[model samples]
Target: MKILIKNGMLVTAERTFAADIFVEDGKISRIENPGTLSVSAEKTIDATGLLIFPGGIDPHVHMHLPTPAGFSSDDFYSGSRAALAGGTTTLIDFVTPHRGEPLKEALEKRKAEAASCLTDYAFHMSPVEWRQHLPEEIKACITEEGIPSFKVYMAYKDSIGLEDDALQKVFYAVAEAGGMVTAHCELGDEIEQLRRDYVQNGQTTPEYHPLSRPAELEAGAVEKAIAMAARANCPFYIVHVSAAGSLEFIRQAQQRKQPVFAESCPHYLLLDDSRYKGSFEQTAPYVLSPPLRKKSDNRALWQALSDGTIQSMGTDHCPFMMEQKRNGLHDFRKIANGAGSVEHRLTLLYTYGVLQNKISLNRFVELISTRPAKIFGLYPQKGALLPGADADIVIWNPEKEKTISAQNHMMHCDTDIYEGFKTTGAPEYVLSSGHVVVENGTWKGKAEPGRFLRRKL
Candidate 1:
């Protein structure tokens, strides 16, 4: 089908224009004056007063993820629902190895499970089983599995974390393949030691989550990882950096002209450790690695994001329901980690950051959409709204005020962490590959429209 979007301001990473976007066969065919071009469309949209931007791309999210806390609250079907409702057209989730499972097997299993996504998506290989055959497996993932990015964690202990040597091996392999290696930089041994001390002192509350994983541990890991990446001459991306010290490490690395970059999440940018109130749902929800930092660090994160030290924004949307989050809360170690915010990322950024003048609207588009596509190698096709690009677009109402509630959330989760948070911007119309999947808060598409995308080498 052919569709014409009339009279909308087209916004891209670098420019904006008042033009009509013509989409044919799920691809943008033209962007021109309303009447200067003559074309017939099966459908026409009168975007009388709206800003049209490339669809948001959430580069980091965890859906249908298997963890000790039962499972990640959202599977593909529900996660895509939440993503589309929030104006994100593409999501790159992780497919990491579980205990005793080959990485390839884990990836294939996830592929089978997510056979019904409604948005375009991709996977980043998370390497947990770092073995003798790990290099070949990484090569196979890039050459055959369509994943050009691999993740290694310095935290998470035996579950997913790799030792420094293992991390170096993965880095060397990915670097040789011209792929990116992202690391979760937090010292596991230090955290475990702190946890032992905390529990020994009977200080096992949810608030201790941050105290257990201090800034120095994160910075130490960051410094070590950066040095290792430099030695291997590999491109590195630090994931969800939180502390001021860690940011400084990244800044110094970039200053030294290392192929090093980092990303910070909204939780780190907008929220702080002092906000933890002991409620498992609230406390455990925010209990991610490189835990929330002090208010001073929050501002630093924003500055990093603004100055381009941080290349992109990612949700890290890993949700565990209320019950799971509360499990063993008195012990803190067994309290499930992660929260759901995939559905609110775009709107929150627009309302709080862009509208409030923390960043420019165009920068918002770049941070959330264009930059991710470019860095992770999904650009041109999935990140922009230009002619010959995929018809992945979002028509957002920048003035709409709405309270976020899981009552209407589509992620199949029982709760939303952003509940009661008021926001001014929300996605009103969404198109994925030329199909209008969401219009006016209602979903309007099939379950399997989404396809897994392989990165271009």
Candidate 2:
């Protein structure tokens, strides 16, 4: 199929231009003036006042991801439904193994479950408890499965956090394989100690969650992880960076020209530790690691975003219902630690952050789209709106104003963290692979149209 999008403002991380886009068989065929077109198209859209951008590529989310709490909050169908509504076209989520399980088998099962999603997706293999045989598995993931990124946690006791020795071994192996290592930086031992003391002292509440995982702990882990990577001569990526102290650590590493990249989430930028208001709405609903920091940290996060210190922004869209969150109420340790922000990622960044003058529109595009693709090796095929690139594009109406609510959300989950948050920009038409999936603010696609993307090395 062929489509022509005429007279639109074309936006990218690098530049903006007034041009007409011609797509053929889902790849961009030409980007030129409208009158320069020579071939006829099956469809032509008049985008006089709209901004045409490459569809968002959110690199961190947890759909169909397994958890000890039983299962992930949302499945592929529901999660992708929400992703489309929010203008994201691709998501790269974690695919880690269960205790004593082979990494390959776990990835295969997770892939089977998400095979019918409604958008393009990819996976990052998380190495939990590293075994001697795991290096061979990491090589296989890169050479065979098309998954090249490896993740390790520095927190989450008994869940997936890797010990320092295990982390070094994995880094050495993945770096040798020409892949990037992404680390979840937080001090597990200190956090565990804090949790023990908090429980023993009867300090179990939503507000106490952040207090338990202090900023110093996160900063200490950041320093340690970076030093480990530096010593191993390996490049690494920091996941969900929250503290100002950690940012400084990353900055120093980068100044020395160490191959390090930092990422932050919208939750850290938009919400604060105050979200833990001693209520269910405040506590369990926002129980992610590196718990949201104070309002002062929020300003530093925005500064990091504006200055290119943070390479990419991802939505860690892990969700659990109110009832599910209740399981962790009496024991704050058991609370399902995640939040729902997949569907609100793009609009919130635009409306509240970029449009509000915290960052430029081009910078916002980089954070949500281009930079992720470059870092993850998707590049021209996934991130840019240019000739010969895939036609994963979003036509946005910048003047549309609406408040978010669970009543209107597409996710199957029962709550929305961004509920009642108003935004001015929205997607009006979305096309993935040259197929119109959403038009005129309504869905026009099926649930299983999405295909899995292999990691590019």
Candidate 3:
């Protein structure tokens, strides 16, 4: 298929200028100043009043994740489709192996599940435990599976978290394998004890969720993880940093020239812990791991993002039905620890981050697409708008406005954590690998399977 886009303001991590893009064989064939060249093709789009950018890339998400309540509502197909609708063309979800499961075996199963994705996808392998033979397995993941990044948790200790000793060992092994480690940092023991203490006094409402896992717990874990990664000399990427105190540690690490990278989410940036102040039905949806922080934390995170202390953003888009949240109605600990935002990352960021001048347009592109692609080994191919790059492009209308509502969302989940969050600017058209899958906020019904991106970092 061939397509040509003319008269659009081309925006990249570097600069923005009016240009014409030629696409052929699923890659950008040429880029030139507006009207410099002409090409006749299958499709020609007149982007006279639009902004053109590389499709958004969300580096963290959880599709079809399993928990005691059930699997996250959006599987790969639903989640990826929703992603495209929001101008995201690529996703890097997580692959978490059960206890005693070989990393390779879990990876294979995860790949099979992601085959249904509607947008290109990849994964961050999660190491739940440390074993003597795990170093060999980590190497195999890098060489054989083409997975060069691993996710380790400091929370969820009972099921998926790693102890400090185990986490350090895994960090060393991945560093040796030429891969980086992505960590979910929250003090597991402290949080566990706090939850117990909260429930013991009969305070089991959702409001207690944030109170149980305070900012100090998350910040303490960040300090410890940074130290551990520095000791092992491993490149570390922190996921879903949600606290002002946590940023102090990360900022210091960067000042000292440590190889620590981080990503924050829209919930943390735009919303606050006050969401948990409502009734169970109102507050349960905001109950996620590393619960939301105060507005002061939100302001601090925006500063970090603007100044380069944070490198990227993600949704951690795990979601369950409202009924799934009822499991913890009596005991807040039983509530599933996630909410849906996969389909809103780009819009929310553009609206608040760019339009508000918190970050420049170039920085926005870097945070959402370029930096993630570079860190995860999908750059030039997935995040760039240069000639020879894959044709995952977003034609954005700066004047478009949207009012988010769960009743109108595309994600399969019942609760929209970003419900009623009005957003400005939206994708007018989205092309995934040169295929126009979305036009004017409607799916074009292109069912072509998304290729699993094999990455090596």
Candidate 4:
């Protein structure tokens, strides 16, 4: 299909200017100054007042993730639907293999599970445990599978976290395999001890969730992970960095010209620890990992984002139903450690980050799309507005206004932590691989499986 989008203000990570984009065969064929291209298409969209951007790319999300509380509410189909409605055309989820399973086997199973996705997707293969043969498996994942990133955990020691020794070994394995390591940083032992103490004292409510996993512990883990990555000479990405001290460490690493990237989520930037003070019904939705920090931490993160200490942002969007959360009403540890926000990532960032003058419009594009694309090796094809790039685009109406309510969201989950939050911008139209999947926050096309992208660094 050929589509002509004319008279739109094209925005990217570096430049913002008026241009026309001509998409053909699911790729951008031309980007010319307005009225300069003599192209004819089956469809001509007059985007006179819209801001055209590369479709958003969410690098950290869990669709159909299995947990003690059951699978996260949004499977790939539902989660990708939400992602499309919010202007995201690509998603990078994770493949967490079991303790003894071969990495390729788990990756295949994960690929089958994500066959229902509505947007192009990729994965960060996780090495939950390190075995001698694991190095070969990691090499095969990079050379044969074409996935060059790995996800590691520093918390959840009982399940996925690797001990320091094993963690270092895996880093070396991934480094040898020429893959990057994206980590969930939190000091597992300290957090486990804290949780036990909190539960033993009868403080088994959602309020204790953040108390158990404090910012210091997250920063401590970040420090350790940075050192390990440096030791292994591996490129590292710290996911959902929610602590101010963690930013300091990341900033220092970047200053040393290390291949260390940092990502922060919207909840950590917009919400605070005060959210945990509410009733369980209200607070349970906020019970995510590396829980929301203090307002001071939020400010520090904003500053870090503005100063280039943080390179990207993701939602960490894994959510469950309220009933799922209720399983942890008496035991905070059991609550599914995620919340739904894939559908709100773009609007929230535009309203709060850009409109509030905390970041430039170009910076917003970088945080939401370009930087992540570059980080996960999907750059020009997924996040750039260049010729030969994928025709995944978003026409944004910056003046569009809406109130974020669970009653009107696209995520399969029932709860919304940002409920009632006012948003100032919206995606007027979203195109995935040259197909219009969403228009005016409504789905416009039939459900189709998104292609599995083999990514590289």
Candidate 5:
């Protein structure tokens, strides 16, 4: 199929210019001045007043995740639909292996589950336990399976988290194979002790969730993880960096010229601990891991983003229904720890980051799309609008305004953390692989599944 998008202002990480984009066979075939080439197409879009951007890439999300509270609300189909409507075309989800299971088996299982996705996707293989043969498995995943990144958990110690010895082994193996390691940084033992203290004192409400996992503990874990990765000589990535102190650790590493990258989510930058002061029902939705920090922390994160200390912004879009959250009404610890924002990430960033003058249009595109693609080895192919790139595009209407509500959202979740928030911009149209998936805020494409991107290191 051929698609021509004419007269739109094309945005990149460095510049924005007026041009017409021509897409053929799911790839960008040409980018020319207005009316430079008289080419015919199956469809033509007049984007005279819109901003053209390469589709957003969310590098951290968990769809169809299994937890103690059954499963997350949105599966691959619904999650991908919401992502497309919100202007995201590619997602990278974690493939967590079960206890004693091989990484290869886990990868196959996740691929099968994501077959219903409507946009391109990739996986970051998780090494939960270190065994004698696990080093070989990590090598195979990088060399044979085309997975160049691995995830390690410093929290959730009772289940998926790894001990220092195990984490060191995984880091060494990944480093040897020229792969990067991403970590969920939190001091599990300290958090678990704090939770015990809270429960023992009869403070078992949802408010205790954030109290047990404080910013100081997160900073401590970040420091420890950096030390371990440095010893192993591995490239490290810290996911969901929420605290101001954690940023210092990352900054120091970068000052030393370490290959350490960090990402902060929208919730960490926009919301704060005050959300936990509401009633249980109101507060449970914000009970995500590495819980929201102080408003001061939010300000520091914004500064870090502006100063280039933080490289990208991801949604960490894992959500559970209200009924699932009700399981922890009394204990707080059992409350599912995630919120839905895959459908609101772009709009919220635009309204808060760009409109508020916190960041520039080029910085916005870099944070949401370009940096993620480059760091995760999908650059130029998935994050650029140049010729020979995937024809995943978004036509943004910068003047449109709308209020966000779960009733009008495309995600299958039961609630929205940013409900009632208004946005001044939205996607006028979205294209995936040269197919018009969303037009004028409505879904118009078929249910054709997205391809599994085998990334390079």
Candidate 6:
């Protein structure tokens, strides 16, 4: 099918201009000035007043994640629908294996689980345990599965976290295989001890969640992980970097020209640890790993985003219902560690980052889309609006305004962290692989099942 989008303000990571985009068979075939193409198309969209951009790409999210409390409320179908509604056409979720499970098996299971997704998706293989055959498995993931990114957790010591030795070994293997590793940086041992102390002092509450996993711990873990990755000659990506101190490590590494990238989420940049002081019902929803930081940290993160210290913005969109969050009422340690924001990430960033002048329009595109594609090996095909790129586009109505509310959200989750927050810009139309999935605030739901993206380094 052929589709033509005319008279839109074309915005990309590098430039902004007025042009008409021509898409053929799910890929952008041409870009030209208005009225340049005289041929008729199967469908023509008049984007006279819209800003056309490559669809947003969220590099971190957890859909249908299994937690001790229960599975996350949004599965692939619902989560992808919400993502499309928010102008994100692609997402990268982690494929986490159980402790001691084979990496290949975990990938297969995750693939089956994500089969219902409505937007293009890929996975980051998580190496939960180091084994003799792990290096071979990493190679297979890169060569066979076409997934070039691996992830390791520095927290969750009891289940999914990896110690320094194991992490270093995995980094070495990934480096040798020409792949990168994204680390969840947090000092698990120290945090465990701190949680025990807080409980012993009879000060257990949602507010204590951030107190236990402090900035210093996160910075320390980042420092150690960078050193390990450096020793292994691995390209390292620090995920959900929440502390100002951690940015120092990333900056120093970048100064040395090491292959290191940093990611920060909207929650860490917009919200603060103060939310933890609310009542149990209110505070429980914000209980995520590497919990929200101080206002000073939030300010530093904004500066980092501007200065290129943080390269990408991801949602880490893992949500639990209010009822599920109540499981930890008596003990904050038992709370599910995530909040739902997959559908709000793009709008929030645009409203606060661009409208508030924290970042330029081009920079906003890079943070939410282009940079992630370049870092994760999905460039051109997923993040560019140039000729020959995938026809995943968002027609943004910058003048439109809306208030975020869980009651009206498309995500299956029952709570919205940004509920009642007002935003200026929104997606007027979203096309995934040349298929119109969302148009004028309505979901078309006519696109075929999303394809599994086989990415390369």
List model 6 lDDT by residue over 1-457, tens digit each.
8999999999998999999999899999999999898767999999998999899999999999998899999999999999999999999999999988888899999999999999999999999999999999999999999999999999887999998889889999999999999999999999999999998898789999999999999999999999999999999999999999999999999999999999999999989988998799889989998899999999999999999999999999999899999898889998888988989988999999999999999999999999999999999899999898999999999989999999999999788888899999999999999999888868888558798999998
Model 4, range 234-308, lDDT digits (tens) per residue? 999999999999988898899999899999899999999999987889899999998999999999999988988
lDDT of 2 at 32: 93
Candidates 1 and 4 compared: the better one by TM-score is: 4
C-alpha local distance difference test of each model: 0.84, 0.86, 0.92, 0.93, 0.92, 0.93
State the lDDT at 372 in candidate 5: 93
- Total clashing pairs for each candidate: 0, 0, 0, 0, 0, 0
Predicted candidate 5 versus true structure: per-residue lDDT over 85-158, tens digit per residue: 99999999989999899999999999999999999999999998989998899889988988999999988889
Error of 2 at 65 (Å): 2.6
Instruction: Provide the RMSD of all predictions against the true structure, rounded to 1 decimal.
Output: 1.6, 1.4, 0.8, 0.9, 0.8, 0.9
lDDT of 3 by residue, 1-457 (tens): 8999999999999999999999999999999999986787898999998999999999999999999999988999999989999989999998899998999999889989998898999989999999889999999999998899999999889999999899999989999999999999999999999999999999999999999999999999999999999988999999999999999999999999998999999999988987988789999999998898999999999999999999998889998899999999999999988988888898999999999999999999999899999989999999999999999999999889999999999999777988888899998999999999888768785669898898977
Given candidate 4, what's the lDDT at residue 168?
A: 97
Candidate 5 backbone collisions, by pair:
none
Residue ranges of candidate 4 with Cα displaced over 4 Å = none
Q: How accurate is candidate 5 locally (lDDT)?
A: 0.92
Q: Measured by C-alpha RMSD in angstroms, how accurate is candidate 6? A: 0.9
User: lDDT, candidate 2, residue 41?
Assistant: 88
Which 10 successive residues of model 2 have the least lDDT summed?
Answer: 64-73
**TM-score, model 4 to reference:** 0.99
Listed in order, each prediction's TM-score against the native is 0.96, 0.97, 0.99, 0.99, 0.99, 0.99
Q: Which of 2 and 3 is ahead in TM-score?
A: 3
